[model samples]
Target: MSTTTTTTTKQGHPPGLYLLFATEMWERFSYYGMRAIFVLYLTQALLLDKNVATDDYYGSYTGLVYLTPLIGGYVSDRYWGNRRSILVGGLIMALGQLLMFISASFYQNFSVSHNVMLLGLLALIVGNGFFKPNISTMVGQLYPEGDSRRDSAYTIFYMGINLGAFFSPIICGFLGDTGNPADFRWGFLAACAGMVVSIITFELLKNKYLITPEGGAIGGTPEKVAQIEDNTPKRSISENIGWAIGALVLAVAFFYGANIDLIGSFIFSLSIIAPLYIILDKSLNREEKERISVIYIAAFFVIAFWAAFEQAGTSLTFFADEQTDRVVFGKEIPASAFNSINAIFIVLLAPIISIIWVQLAKKGLEPASPAKQAFGLLFLSIGYLVIAFGVKDLNPNVKVSIMWLTSLYFLHTIGELCLSPISLSMVNKLAPPRFAALLMGVWFLSTAAANKLSGTLGALYPDEKLIAAGKIPSIFGFQITNLYEFFMVFVVFAGVASLCLFLLSFRMKKMMHGRG
Candidate 1:
């Protein structure tokens, strides 16, 4: 396994890190830009029911976005390798964003616009699968084993993600939400422009900046690309044909779900199967299996953390749009602008948190990765609790102050600092070399499940049915009704999960077999 360059010229870090940083930054700009507007476009522009948008379309789109990475990661690991996968994926995604722009250009044609939107979404989903997991893998590949900087490197990388996220909503929302319903397509067009910038930036700088200390290109296949192959394959051409047909069938199923329904089920099944397929590979040594077990355990906790955290694009967006008072200086602020709050906080806090981790490590006081993750969940729960309390006496006809949501985002950003980047570093460190990108995809599978679950939970946002029935929806005995009640559910759910994870941390660290 050729992991790192042998050459050593120590200053701060390698150039490849910043190159990937810039690439991922623009990619996130495109992604988060689209996300900032998607639900609003569905509910406000298309005039779909809010419940359907959250429960079905939003859930399916985000879920499939993560699900396809399983295919992309596997194919990259087996054949395409990371650089080629990213190049191809970037092109496809840029085209996908263009298709979305076309969808918006035909905004007046209801049937045609909707069909084009579906096609655009399909392209984005396919493109992202190839782009998301592989790029993160390249980051880890730049560093050698047991390097302390890996964690901070990912944190720095995460800031690049937030840097793009912070500006995108401001730009995209300004263009799309210009107080005119017809102008919403402009946001999608802006997203297309972001994708174009992302790929072009990558292509221009990758050769110069994306290299190790020894000047070795990262993400390229170690051997000739044509020689890439699976460890074992059936010699029969019919078997290969049969597998190709199966892939086509799966894609068709995704298309049907994208068009009509049942995407959640497909994603749930794939989430289980993809990781299991990796873990059961006969080539993994005993230590690798144990390390993988740790990833699964951590992923379970991550699902809990993200299920609540990911609501920024779903429930929180709805809250900001419909329930939060956006008046500042007597002018109403755009709801999508609120999405940038989390990113803004991340931009401000990430470097501070990165420094804190290093300082703590120097003093031998830094928490283990699992413990840090538990703390992340704890902060997430506290964030929800803070908002839940503020909304306890809220009037239905009136909106709460923006401070409440801003404060919630602040806490969530702190929690993210602890959990999200750490989890990425954990996967990078623990996964076997051959399975690197594939395991990264599996790590994202946790987020896929969380994204879908967040959407499902978003559906429980005290809609007409629950309000009309005069009964709050109770899950695990927590009643949910108004903004306060709905928010309380997450408080209890994440709080309990965080506590459980904290209890399990000691055992989990032991299971890491000195890796932690």
Candidate 2:
């Protein structure tokens, strides 16, 4: 029973590892930069109205963004090889970013032209489908299987993501929304520039990192002579044609999700899940089935967590806008600015937490996997409670200060630090090697599903406002007219899910059969 682990001594592996880090850093700068403004632009600048269309837009955008990584991951693992796939994905995404800039420009001219916006959105969704998975896969390939540093590597990688997200809102939000079109142009340009910067850095370092993964390029310009996997599936023309139709049909279904309600959304999600489930069920062995079962179960708990957690972008943002007082030392800040708090917290706390996890793991005092996840959920739930307390304290005429919101964000960030990245690493490690990337895809599919639900939950609160504030719709027959009431329900949901996971951990561990 040899259990030898791979090690990447500080000087070991290629110097290019850090280059990829830098590349990823800039790409995040582009992504979060755009994300910070996308919603604001839609509601405020473009005036699309916030109720149904807004959540749909967010759900569709974020869900599809996550879902495409499956296609990207499979293309890399089975056909393109990681490096080539990464390059292709990066270039595609870069083009998409420029297209998005064009979109903003068109928006400036046409204001509410749906066609331009749709095209830009399509470009981004498609481009992200290619980029996200490939880049993460590249990071994993930088180390051997079971590498001790892999967790740290991902932490570092995640940090790169957060650091960019942390700054993008501050900079892009400032520039893009700086009371003039000139500032907006600079913001969009900064996004495009950051992506290009990342792409160039990636290209330079591609060769060095290729030292171990040892595969030739697979995708770039259509002209380049690149190698494909020798056994890349040679589907018959009829089968390929059938798949094309199936994909089109599936795309149509999800595209409709942009306009439909929970029923339509659920139908679309089930369309993806049902077929995949039947295939996995019918094809895999007992052990494999059980392993995937854990993954799926984990998926549900994740949905529970994300439904609560994702309120940060939607419901929480709205709360900050209407209810929470934004007086930071007597000067008011925009509600959207609070959205940056979680990323900022991550940038500051991630390294310290990562080090603690590593040290604890080495000492055998690290909490078991399920417990950690449960802990994350607990914090998230508690965070909502913390905010609710602030609401309780405010006088009829007086408002709570920004510090309370920041405090709540700190708790949610702690929960996120515990749950999110840990889950990614867990998926990569626990999945059977043969189906590694696909399992990762399934993992992200969970994210896709969870995100869609997150949007719905944003709309799911009570109208505590009309009853409590003015004429506003309740999310779930409850008057969300009050920010505290809306957020508290989600927080409570997360806490309950955490407790359930905690109680079930021992049973789940038994089923894991030591695989975890």
Candidate 3:
């Protein structure tokens, strides 16, 4: 119940920040390492059709991964609390990675391997629901209210995420993506090991460092919820259940009407309904409603950004594997290894961006969070534009320079620097303390929608085989005959979304009151 600020070091941040950093780093290592090779495993080892692999399985798995965070966030807010949720989630994810290792190990036995892989994906999706939101919410708790350092702290935390991501592809790709199906188990096993390390680190450190500035434990059980009085009217348990059932019915109706697959429908529907449910709560005042509306609005725009950015694991990997000139110094780079490029760029640039934000704050020149995200979308569009031009007029059979793809990732990294961490900090700043973890989950819900769309777009990757089969690839009725057009799809989506968000940024900032 103490109101004192948490202790800090010479670095101007709490020591617990590093602890959470290490924990999140290893979890991302586990997740990204497995992801770096998942598509390849489906296409090469399992010999599934590329479209089916990306559009159905890969998209569903990744989308569901983000979707389940809603459940985890709600559970943490209502019952388990952040620390316990993280531990449980980390353990399940480790098991999921271990199952993936088994799945890769049994690749020769197609049925067993495929079934086990599905089970593994399920575990990971559920586990991530618990782990992802809680960890992010805790980052904000490390600082007291009105702390200007929060944004910089998130940027530093984001660096840890990228640091793990940077290494995962290199290490996992080296071990598993060596053109031999039998070797993938080693990469998955490495991911499993990373998850185990993450769990152990959190268990050892949470009590010691993961605390509020006032020396109170952060993310404790519901019994230890913050002592701040709530004047808002509380909903009855029956009313909450009624809302849940109503949302489920609406989601099912959307699934049938949307013509997309079941998982996609569920993700997209919940992304909309979940936030509406929160906003409609009778307990929220006018100010809280406006702030939450800003979160929802930003989340809507974020969908477009992630839908385009997430292609790294799908269509982009295909480009690297088949169209890019990967040979260098007499060795061929694994397609999965290219996934590390964005991560490496983030590692190199996060500190600089962090400094830039801090300096801008000092001068009172800092853009509102929404404006930063608008610039993010702009950078993303430009990244795609760069690659679109790079591939224009190039022969289908001829590989382009690796520099083209490298340049695209560089711009996307800048876009991510602008948006992702800023959004996290914004949610932390704007969310009611009682709803902190749940609101973070709501933010990730946008990512779930984006990832699902990423898979759908990835399926449109203009494969020659599909074209030869008379199945022309298109999005919204426009044909994608080659890489040029495919890349432009992203350019247009991000560009339009960026311009629109920029125009609305001022209004959204006003909704934040003085918090902006």
Question: All candidates' lDDT scores?
Answer: 0.83, 0.67, 0.91
Q: Which stretches of candidate 2 lie over 4 Å from their true place?
A: 1-16, 108-112, 179-185, 213-284, 322-334, 393-399, 460-472, 475-477, 513-515
Question: Residue by residue across 1-516, what tens digits does model 1's lDDT show?
Answer: 334344342336777788888888888888888888888888777787776888787887887888778788988987788888998898888888888778777777879878988998899999999999999998987776776678878998998999999999988888886666677788888888888888888888887877655567877764543342355332367755654565456645655765424676566666666676677766677888989988988898888898899888888998998889999999988898888999999999998988898899889998888999999999999999999998888877788889999999999999999999989998898888877888888888888888888888887787655468685555667666678888988898899999998899888888788777
Q: Which stretches of model 3 miss by more than 4 angstroms? A: 1-11, 224-232
- For 1-516, candidate 2 gives per-residue lDDT tens digits of 122222234335445457667878888888778776666666665556554544677766766666666776666556665567666767777777777676666565654445666666677766666677666655665665666667677777788788877887778777776544434545666777888888898887666554443333322332221223222344468865665566556655665746556433543464365335423533355766666666666767877887677777766666676667876677767665676899889988998888888888789888766667888899988888988888864544566667778998999889888887777676666665445555676677667777777776766543343355556656447655455666677777897899888887676666665655
Q: What lDDT score goes with residue 18 in model 3?
A: 97
Best by TM-score: 3
Residues 69-186 of candidate 3: C-alpha lDDT, one tens digit per residue: 8899999988899999999999999999999999999999999999999999999999999999999999988887898788888998999999899999999999999999999999
Using TM-score as the measure, name the better of candidate 1 and candidate 3.
3
**Pairs with steric clashes in candidate 3:** 5-213, 6-213
Model 1 gets an lDDT of: 0.83
